[model samples]
Target: GAEADKGSLGPDKIGGGAALADGVGGGSALGGGSSASSLALEALVRGVRDDVLALHLDVLNHFQAAQEAQTRAMEEMQSRQEAMASEVASLRRQLSAALQQRDEFRWL
Candidate 1:
């Protein structure tokens, strides 16, 4: 749906608008104050609006993808941190056990 809709926005508007806008010229589309001139202005406005919407969609998609990637990276980092914490706890327990054995031997 999106691909198809965006597909329409480009060629038709660029091609048609270029032709009509050239014919309509700059000031006449407004200064002429004719119904035909107004219609051309309306068409130009619609073309610009469509182009802006398409650009907005592109930016939004990029931002969403970036956010998703950031979320995945955060999750991976969290997992790594948790694993390191557990490993550190295990090493501390081992160190305590060694110290206890040394103290007992010293008492003998």
Candidate 2:
């Protein structure tokens, strides 16, 4: 049987030596795998960022629409309140005139 060669730095080297070096350095499987992983992670992060931004925009749009609806509702309520106030004033004048006529008739 052929003697098993440990690695580029030889079997006497400690802790898997030059074998692990090749795995981490250029032209090795680990190097290619590391670069591929980094690229994939970057792409995933960008996609997530874009998705979050889209969601934020959607939320802002909804809030703006709600604000506009609230403004319209407030305007309508204000107009109704003004109308009611005028009606109340007219009714008060009519009631006062009627009371004055009743008192005059009693006095006569």
Candidate 3:
């Protein structure tokens, strides 16, 4: 019954026990014997490293895109501010000229 229970545990239930029995456990769970487990561990590590590198690159790309968008927004805002400043200056000059004309006519 103990053997039957062990068999019934399955790979997922026993946390990769079947993989260990199959000589591909990466030597982390089962005892080390040959270079095959080492190779498997190396392959797993490489795969994880590649995935992390890909994620890092993706994040960098997103950050660069966001930075570019922010730069464009700032430039647009600066242009609008300059345009508003120019309009305000023109209005002030027109008001000053109109006041001068009014004063001259009143004195006449």
Candidate 4:
């Protein structure tokens, strides 16, 4: 819009805040500030973006580590549950054998 409205002589093309008079001049774009200020703003934005990215990466790493720890804990719990089930089954078999022996003794 700036280039279209101001023609080829807009201040934007000259990097000046105002137009260069009757000669073809590019006008300032949407009242934008000087190029130096824009560059500074860009640098500031870039720095902030970098900081956010770094923090995001850190969070991802922490989440990944936590997930891995939880997975290990779940696996350990599952193993313990299996062991307990096996022990219970062994105990049941022993109880059944004992009862059988007692019945034989009674018959004798």
Candidate 5:
């Protein structure tokens, strides 16, 4: 009686041994059996793949937006720096001209 019970408890006796099955070819307890299990697994994989691809695309879009914003900021900074340089040059030229006029007046 004990041996009979043990045999019944073996992997093969349960779920058509589907749990112990190695791969797609392996049997399953599902009503449609091994093929159904394989199809279900494939569908799950495909769904995950699609979701991951969508997430990757969203990340890329965000990255591109950030890059564009940074570029604009850099360009604005560069333009401001150029304007400041021009102002400084103009101030220096005015100072030089004023100094030359003072020297001429001292000689007079």
Candidate 6:
């Protein structure tokens, strides 16, 4: 009867005396679990930061494209303005020559 009372169960058995004896009030029971949860939280924060950074890059790209298009339009307008100014100057010279010929004919 005493032998049966003192018999040792397998180490993996739940509620075994050996397992309870080993769990001598360790500082915190969930230390490993808490560390794992903290790591997961840090990972989530990093992922959100990366997403925001990508969005910012996209916005910057769009702004640069718009600026380039505006610059091109301005250059084309300037080119057209220069051509119109040259045409006006040429027409003024032709009008002046015609008037001078008409005055000489009237005097004859």
lDDT top scorer: 1
Candidate 3 to native Cα RMSD, angstroms: 16.0
Task: Give lDDT for model 3.
Answer: 0.64
Range of the 10 consecutive residues with the lowest summed lDDT in candidate 4: 18-27
Worst 10 residues of 2 by lDDT: 1-10
Report the lDDT tens digits of candidate 3 across residue range 1-108.
453233332335434423334433455444564477676775675566556655665565566666767999999999999999999999999999999999999999
How would you encode candidate 2's per-residue C-alpha lDDT over 60-91 as one tens digit per residue? 55666667679999999999999999999999
lDDT of 4: 0.60
Best-to-worst TM-score order: 3, 4, 2, 1, 5, 6
Model 3 ranges off by over 4 Å: 1-34
Per-model TM-score on C-alpha atoms: 0.64, 0.65, 0.65, 0.65, 0.61, 0.59
lDDT of 6 by residue, 3-108 (tens): 4223323333334333433322231432434466655654555565556655665565566566767989999999999999999999999988999999999999
lDDT of 4 by residue, 1-108 (tens): 443332333224434322212121222332355466665665565566556655665565566666767999999999999999999999999999999999999999
Model with the higher lDDT, candidate 3 or 6 = 3
Deviating ranges (above 4 Å) for candidate 2: 1-34
The model with the greater lDDT, 2 or 5, is 5
TM-score preference between candidates 2 and 3, better one:
3
Give the Cα-based TM-score of candidate 6 against the true structure: 0.59
* TM-score of predicted structure 3: 0.65
| CA lDDT scores, all candidates in order | 0.69, 0.61, 0.64, 0.60, 0.62, 0.59
CA displacement after TM-score superposition, residue 89 of candidate 2 (Å): 0.2
